[model samples]
Target: MANIMLTKDQWDALQRHLLPNPFKVEEAAFLFVKVTESGDFECVDSWCMQPHDFDYQSAFHISLRDETKAAVIKRAHDTGTALVEAHSHLGKWPAEFSRSDLCGFDSFVPHVRWRLKGKPYAAIVLTTADYDGFAWIGDATDPVRIDGLVIGDVDRLGPTGLTPLTWGPWEDFDGHI
Candidate 1:
């Protein structure tokens, strides 16, 4: 497996997305960090606004919907990219994956492996405020802590002025400026 990872800068960008403006109630923009067979990590595509609704006629929840699932499968199949589904949590609670998160994994893992020819995949969960996150790979039944990752700021948009700027993967608090 490659040493796949996400930078703090990226996380800051994601936090801005969790806000419930005209978009959150209906959808979520899916982002990811894909590790290639060549052992390099890159932030690939972004699903501008993935619908949060799913089957069962329940209230639209915050999560990767079926359409988002299809998109993930296609990306994995076409590029041989391992999965890394990242999304924002919109509250002050220290970021953690909710039940919906597990549901997402249960629904996606098999399809990812089968569709991508058994490539390893991971899920990245972050807070709306960029306070905490974790990575889940291989065993959707298990979760791993991301050591050395911290959030210095949140809600500031990136160069495009639409995405926030998140920073992480720091050795210590090396004076983040």
Candidate 2:
């Protein structure tokens, strides 16, 4: 079996929290992960998408922004963690990065590379129904790989499921680490 880099608790907490949003206004969330020398990954910090200078829908059209981008960078800097960016897709999941996602990456990765001196970064694609993530190494357009999540307790398809992770509170659970 391939080694599990992220812990079960982390997976559970992420599933218990983050959820998809269906509003027309675009929403975003910031995430950071601490990567140990041994290659283990742990959550460091997370922030919900707050309305910034850009008009809400404008962010959706332009992709994520510098303030949010800076939050990701700050978390990585503080914890010596690799950067991980996550957001909700409401109820959709495109097979590949959308034009906006690509745009967001184009603006951020170069900053991350310069700040971390070329360290690896991760991106998480989430929906109210399911979840997946990617590790962007050499190129943002081509992720190293994608992983379907196995969230504990919560059924991906159930009548009374919580909103997708983004709609929930931003939490830091030690158990999740």
Candidate 3:
């Protein structure tokens, strides 16, 4: 399992973008991250999707415009960084990926790996109070849990506090395999 580390300021900025006031619907973003020597992802920058970036959006779903997707890919290509796709889930739902989200990943992840020359790709789903993440590393077919998050010097996702709900093979939900 790998972790993602970001400065306090970066975390703050990302939260603001993700959980804005009047947040009536889900929002999405692409985080451009560099793999650190210690095998963690360091967020270098992010592109928060705007209204015009999406072809459709509601409280439960969002579809990025083709141009928006292309732009995010291009940015990762230009920056030579791995990509982490992120989005929000409204209300009190757990921060877990939906079946629809997994279906989307089936196509998108392979395309991204090909375009980015086999660089890893990841996704994180955030609710108001928690998050869960997964990563497809190298040629692996299944994803590993993104087990922790380090905000500045604090371990926000460690076992003792704010731990994400377990998903994938470790647990099952809604008949998800």
In order of appearance, the predictions have TM-scores of 0.56, 0.60, 0.87
Record all residue pairs in model 2 with backbone atoms less than 3 Å apart, i.e. clashing. Answer: 18-164, 18-165, 18-166, 19-163, 19-164, 19-165, 19-166, 20-164
Total backbone collisions, model 2 = 8
Runs of candidate 3 exceeding 4 Å displacement: 158-177
User: How well is each residue in 1-177 modelled by candidate 3, as lDDT tens digits?
Assistant: 678888998888888888888889989988899987766888999998999999988887888898888889999999999999888878875577776577677679899889999988888887787887888887886777886778999656732223233334423534322
Error of 1 at 168 (Å): 31
lDDT of 3: 0.80
| All-Cα superposition RMSD per candidate | 11.5, 11.1, 4.5
**Per-candidate local distance difference test:** 0.47, 0.50, 0.80
Q: Which candidate achieves the best lDDT against the true structure?
A: 3
Question: Per-residue CA lDDT of candidate 1, range 1-177, in tens?
Answer: 233344565544554554544333423444444654554345565444534433321223454457657876786677656655555555455555555555555546677667776655554444444433334445443444433232333322211111222223344533211
lDDT of 1 at 145: 41
Q: How many clashes (backbone N, Cα, C below 3 Å) per candidate?
A: 12, 8, 0
* Best-fitting candidate, scored by TM-score: 3
